[model samples]
Target: MNSASDLGALAHPAATPAALPTFDDVLAAAARIAPHAHSTPVLRSRTLDALAGCELHFKAEHLQRAGAFKFRGACNAVWSLPDATAARGVVTHSSGNHGAALALAARTRGIPCHVVVPHNAVAAKMAAIRAYGATLHHCEPTIAAREAACAAVQAQTGAELVHPYTDARVIAGQGTAALELLGHDGRFDALVTPLGGGGLLSGTAITAAAVSPATRVFGAEPAGAADGFASLQRGERVLELAPDTVCDGLRGLLGAPNFALLRAHRVEVLLADDAATVQALRLFWQRAKQLIEPSSAIALAVVLANRERFAGQRVGIVLSGGNVDLDALAGLFASA
Candidate 1:
């Protein structure tokens, strides 16, 4: 077993502020990911805009290769590794999509991949991870258990740990989505994305800060798992969470580096109840004709909930993922 000090080192924030990736790094990541990642389309819905009272630009990352924006970070992390280190393969702990993303990324590079997964992860995501040929190590849902499992795998296989978030390379990779989103003609007043570990939100915030400083970045989170909201308010990373939301993908603990980036960029965190998220999920499906997870739906939910602030403005949203389990949809929505 790893010592408490070792785990503490892994959990704590990096000391130097320079650890955050620069805008130039995001640009480099965009070029690096071009071969493996897709430039997901920017979609607009007349009905969605009318409902939200804003010109909504949706970055359709759900249609990405691994069914989420996570592939951007995962692919970047995998390829960033030196040939010698990459040959040893890679490992990580994830609730679902990140695991699947990393697994697929490793496959493209002809490498072995291992993932430490919680038993409660969505079935469809778990299936996708295995389909990508990654060996799965099941563990309890708690962060401690997940990290321990990941460490064990790393120790045994000599694999490099590509953390789901908090890594500079991963954050840069996640920022590439926003780089592409901002590359379009319109200038957005606010951009929103679902926040979990803060990889996507931090990356997006970093990109927005450089590319479009006037644009405010918003993080939509489940009220039941409102760590991001709590952290931003308290000015520190908060991990004590008893997540009880239907958006399984947004339940991960907030990341330290991710918290620092959000703070630096002054990103706003918004909360929505599980019921509202479900309602928004249906609204997105009906209006935009896109099948997104409850996590992604929450991004639009917060904006719609605060329509007055965004009225007659331009808004950009990252439709983060679409890997929800169809079989569990009935029960998930019924709970709300």
Candidate 2:
């Protein structure tokens, strides 16, 4: 991967509150990233639908650029920069998909991109980030370590920090998926997505609130890393935990902005365990003929675990990513 240590600081325009993105921003993002990001297809599975008792409309974000919906947010952040600042570069800290997605987005703009990644992040995802030509800095898996490392990189490199989930631009970018999904033909009763740092879920909530107010927005999270669920229950954001789930991408604490927006939209969060996620992964692969990472499978897991919530309704699910490490596949399935 190529590295540019010193692109030199450049002036960046400040964005005002009025400039904050709304549903219209999501529509614009779809147009902005259309040339680069794929408008991934919506999939269906008769067998799975019968099993869950819901008509499922799966937004195949696993087929998205960078193999995840993170690309949407990353693409927006990279493109939103002023020409002078973009020339200087962009930086972020991520467990995996966000970093890789940002790197891919930066590559298109021909700018320097630096990623501070947790050491425990998936190996294949790390390789993907590096392969996209971003400079990598390893950090302890804790949120503090990732933030400190990312801050140091930005200070040293003069790269704008496009946080994995907290930034408004990222959230606006992530919403475009649902905009497209909900904009399609039928009326959806509900929309479900895996909640990690809550970028995808936050965006979905924002878009659903505007376009389909009647459609409930649901967030599915791992039981082992259920702070997001906990936060939503307590009516506030919560501290981080040392996550112990197979969904590596969903381990982080909920971002404050994400928390606030989720509350604003009254988004409902559902929890699923590692075993249920594993089972969902297998079912998706076998029935849909599609491979989704454990993080992505959590949405489906929640749906199956609580069949009544989505029963006899048209529900749309955003399959977040498909960047699982190949070597760990057998162990993941066998252990479950």
Candidate 3:
């Protein structure tokens, strides 16, 4: 078991915070992803503002296709592949959102999609992947096992590997959320995103640094899986506690490329306990009337916990996804 405290010390062999992508990289990414992604809505919450002591603007990516911002990057990666490369289809290892997103994207591009999914992944997400006509390859729950299984699948299928987060094209596509948020309104003092694999937040940092340079970018992680926070403090990348936290979507460790971009941009990382995240998720549902995943609630948790930091300022938050199961949600927020 990896303690949150020990995460700072776990050394990643190839970890280094260099090669931050430039504004041009983000611009190109926006162009590449624009055709495939929706310009998701920007939502404001009066009740949430009252609670957090800040004016909050939410980029409602949960309303996005495939129910998450993951679709944007997935589509970009799939489309960017050469025709010959895409002929064999694209493959990735994802627990849920990315799998479905890639499946849908590949279907659009007239290519096959293969997703290596963990046996314990959310049932709804798996169903979505199947609905998009993608083949599923099951794997063990561990990150290493997942990666290994993906490699085996790629070798057998001769598919182009589209990593969920690590690839540059994917990062660029993820950055489009920040682009739309800033483009719609550059009034935010800070932009906060849940730090899962550091995909959207890294892209957020990249885009914010370019268009809204004055706006600070921050990442929120589950306290139980605070590897990103630890890595930032240690000046290196670190892996998370495997299979920890109810925020399953945010379980992945910060990828090397994302860690590098985050460090270069000096993105602040914060951790919220599962209790806090659950409360925030409930609050968003009850008060804001917005459906979101626990990972999405981490951003609001940070604002509510650290009022002084965001108080009276405009803060932009990305509502990353809303793919939670109905039964699970009933259990989560049932009357006490």
> Which numbered prediction scores highest in TM-score against the true structure?
1
**Could you tell me how far off, in angstroms, the CA of residue 29 lies in candidate 1 after the best superposition?**
1.0
C-alpha TM-score for every candidate: 0.92, 0.90, 0.90
Q: Show model 1 residue runs off by greater than 4 Å.
A: 1-18, 119-123, 140-145
Q: TM-score: which is higher, 1 or 3? A: 1
**Full-model lDDT for every candidate:** 0.85, 0.83, 0.81
Q: How would you encode candidate 1's per-residue C-alpha lDDT over 1-336 as one tens digit per residue?
A: 112211221343343434678788788889888999999999999988998888999999999988999999999989998999898899987646788899999998999899887776556667888999999888876657877887898888889988777888889999999999999745889999999888999999999999999999999999988988998899877766567678877776678788888999999999999889999999988877889999899999999899898899999999999987788878876877
Candidates ranked, most accurate by lDDT first: 1, 2, 3
Off by over 4 Å in 2: 1-21, 118-123, 139-145
The local lDDT score (0 to 100) that residue 73 gets in candidate 1 is: 94
lDDT leader: 1
lDDT of 3 by residue, 134-168 (tens): 99888776656666777897888789887677767
- lDDT tens per residue, model 2, 1-336: 101110001001111212345787787788888888988899998899999998999999999988999999999989989999998799987646888899999998999999887666556767888999999888776556666787798888789988777778888999999988988745799999998778899899989988989999999998987888888888866664546788877876787778787888899999998999999999998888888999999999999999988889999999999987788888798768
